[model samples]
Target: QQTPASYYFTEKKAAETRIQPRQKFSHKGTFGHALLVAGSFGKMGAAVLSGKACLRSGAGLLTMHVPACGYEIMQISLPEAMTTVDKHEKINTQLPELDAYSAVGIGPGIGKEQPTVELVEKLLDTIGVPLLIDADALNILSENRQLLDKLPAKTILTPHPKEFQRLAGDSSNEFERLEAGRQFAIRHQVIICLKGANTAVILSNGDVHFNSTGNAGMATGGTGDVLSGIITSLLAQKYPAEDAAILGVYEHGLAGDRAAARRGQSALIASDVVEYLGW
Candidate 1:
């Protein structure tokens, strides 16, 4: 008897085993650098979670570019991470030099002042590598839709439904929402991970993979930040964008589930997911 395809699950170990490849003699330099730009006044938790998740996902070196005010908090909280203190207390209209990093993640807890929007545009214009974009970065894109076409090919954009609607234009229903996601990916020459129930990851070539590992417990504020980290790490480790989106989304949801199992859904924090990254 044929079972419903929606009834199946992609096991956590299945993704990890399939996606984690090998090197004959790997070194610290082999894994590649990941740069994360995150944090703001009340949202420092996003920065903390993303930095930790990147390390857990095995990025060899990480530098978090945050606003000046977050410098001491970030450094004290995560000693292993290096930071760039943008003097404006928030990342303003200046674009950081991104040439060194293999992968980048941005937009977690980034507030949308006018200058921040300009900085986002500058980053999109200047960055030459794959990116995992989230949060207010997606918001900034929605505000300025033309920036979508200018994004680097192979970049990964993680947007929740509201953000997805803003970036891809409004959707009247679920089917339209997904079609909008797929079209945006192809048009931008990148990957789109619309995070929600049965999270849909659409690629530039018109492939869509719906993930089934997460639950409503992961709807917390910092969950997307952790997801941004996972995809950033995967890209830094040289996973193709599609595989990274598929596998990273799977593992991220599973990690959230693991956190929920231990802490219960009500108390399942985003940090718990990062803590269980090794489990």
Candidate 2:
């Protein structure tokens, strides 16, 4: 079936209008705190990338909850963000108190260990603020389908094609996949950023907004983590879920586009994308 053109939007001017300008009188607290639960023993880079992007994208205060193995790495890689070490030395096994955070983003490099799965479940049940789920967290949801109903309304899930396929089941083609995403978002009452060229931001109301920036070079690893951080930052700042997803996706891709221009598509890395985040 053909989707209506009216249902599709390109987030250029719309994203610009939604970006909140900082006021001189506004202090760090005014921007809101963001908590990121990420990383594992060998994949601490994911935590670093996400944490750095979170701070760079305007999160006033950012905290990374990582396993002991990642604590020092996160501290040195992202000194601007605070760190909370998990009890488990290799993987995340504890849920930090969420009351202080304005928003949370989870599932970067955290492996699919049983303890981490339990932690994810615990967070889902207890968290009252805006949430963003990505990477391994999305994989956990795929493995434990029952948890889908536990998702808070308007929670954002950023999934590349494979992760989305795992969550929503396989589609014969991209069109089928997009429709599946729309249905999934509507049924779950969550926002889905189906990552790809012109990545589609599917809202709970079934609206689809395609991103206007980005390049194929962004296919590198850790880029999705960067996007999760960016969106989480916006969510922390109190952007409506719809606006956060739309603008975050746009800004993430715009950064990728800028990085590609400087480093050439083949040389661009996720950190380069972070360095180019202009707004």
Candidate 3:
């Protein structure tokens, strides 16, 4: 019989099992470039936060694609990351070269514009690398349920309970929701990082790893974007899909724990979580 101890994933274990050490011969290009397609008009902060977190998590380079209106803001706010501007000033209509990036993360603060639907569809059809889907991107998937089938093998999906409900339909409780998540991962051959307390990382093999870090302090806006960045960064660093999800989720929550300790829950913000990603 399965016991609680059998399922628990603790911080100490996660730290010991984190990404491998960097080699002395490694260069900037060795880590791979990560592309983040995100932001809208007033939500440019989302793009900035995700980009910062991605770099902080060990992505060698980052290119953040945003609407033209956000170009200056992204450049000014995150000088470390390069920027690509979409044709439209407030929405993303043009898609960049999918082959250019080692990994792609999309949907933080992106509004559900009609053109974005087509862009997401085109990405799923064309992208050959691992993809991380979250926030508005998940909503777009719900609207076009058919697109779920086009997801690249081993795609990573980060969703809260409400977002999961939209994709998989309503659930009576957390138990039912998790069962659905496990089935969803198995059916689609993808990883599901179901964000919340414990943040269940459901693998395609029907295994669910519960993160034992993080705190109520992380229950605020923009934190999910940070999580997305961390996972995307891990993918860029070439961690396998299942390992990336499990390790990224654990580290993200562990950062939150550190943030809470330093700032207290009330004062902890998403940027603090990014700052505390020393592991």
Candidate 4:
């Protein structure tokens, strides 16, 4: 079957246009503080990766909320980020003051425990700023469909194919899935960063911007967390939701392309993408 040509293209230059040079006199407070809720007992790496990427992506300050067990790991691995420990050792059950952070990114390694589910609900109720939802949070939304309407306006959701399938039901082909994603975004009044191939950014008004960066080398673990972090950082920097999704996705894929060029597709890992995120 033939696929329709995309009318919207996320050009590399356009993404670059959105990145403004920082003022030398500005303090860290000039950029926004990003709150990241991620990781579990065994998945502490996710928190580290996301936090690191957020910092590298130019967020002024980053606070990582992880399970208690990941405290030492997060502190040692990513000293640039401040760490907050959840009461639970393996999964988060508590909520934090949402007013402090300019933007919040959740999920990553978060497990789908009942307490975490409750935590997600509480977050939806409390978060007033931009939010980036991914991984387990996406899973939580897929399972608990009732929470869909509760999301903050212009919330960004990053989901791969299988994950999107769970949220919007399966489609027979990529073209069909893309259409489903468009409808899903419009129905939910949210931005969908459908990650894969040329990652598609679907807006609530039904516009689809296909990213031209990225390669097969990025098909590894932790990359999605990196993408989420980048998007969250852009949000913290005060990019509008639609612009953030489009630019972040383009830069993420561009970084992936750079990583693949240097390390080759088979050798590329999520960290490499973060390392190659050259502004």
Compare the candidates by TM-score and give the number of the best one. 2
Off by over 4 Å in 3: 1-10
Ranking by lDDT: 2, 4, 3, 1
Cα lDDT computed for each candidate against the true fold = 0.82, 0.92, 0.89, 0.90
Error of 4 at 188 (Å): 1.1
Per-residue C-alpha lDDT of model 4 across residues 15-103, encoded as one tens digit per residue: 77877779999889988999999999899888888888889888999999999999999989998999899999898888888888999
The regions of model 4 sitting more than 4 angstroms off are 1-6
Q: Give the clashing residue pairs of candidate 3, or none.
A: none
- Model 1 TM-score? 0.91
Candidate closest to the true structure, highest lDDT: 2
Tell me the tens digit of each residue's lDDT in model 1 across 1-279: 211122223465556665765577988689989999888777778898888898888888899888887889889998988888787875534567888898888888888888888888888878877788898999988888788777889788899998887787887899778777776777678888888977888877656777878888898878888988888988888888878888888989888888888889889888888887753
Q: Which regions in candidate 1 have their CA more than 4 angstroms from the true location? A: 1-14, 22-24
Q: After superposition, how far is residue 4 of candidate 1 from its true place, in Å?
A: 21
Worst 10 residues of 3 by lDDT: 1-10
With candidate 3 superimposed using the best TM-score fit, by how many Å does residue 118's alpha carbon deviate from the native?
0.5
Tell me how many clashing residue pairs each candidate has. 0, 0, 0, 0
The ten-residue window of minimal lDDT in model 2 covers 1-10
Query: lDDT tens digits, residues 125-243, model 3?
Result: 88989899999999999999999999877899999989999999998999888888888888898989988999998887778788889999999999999998998998988888888
* Residue 243 lDDT, candidate 2, scale 0-100: 91
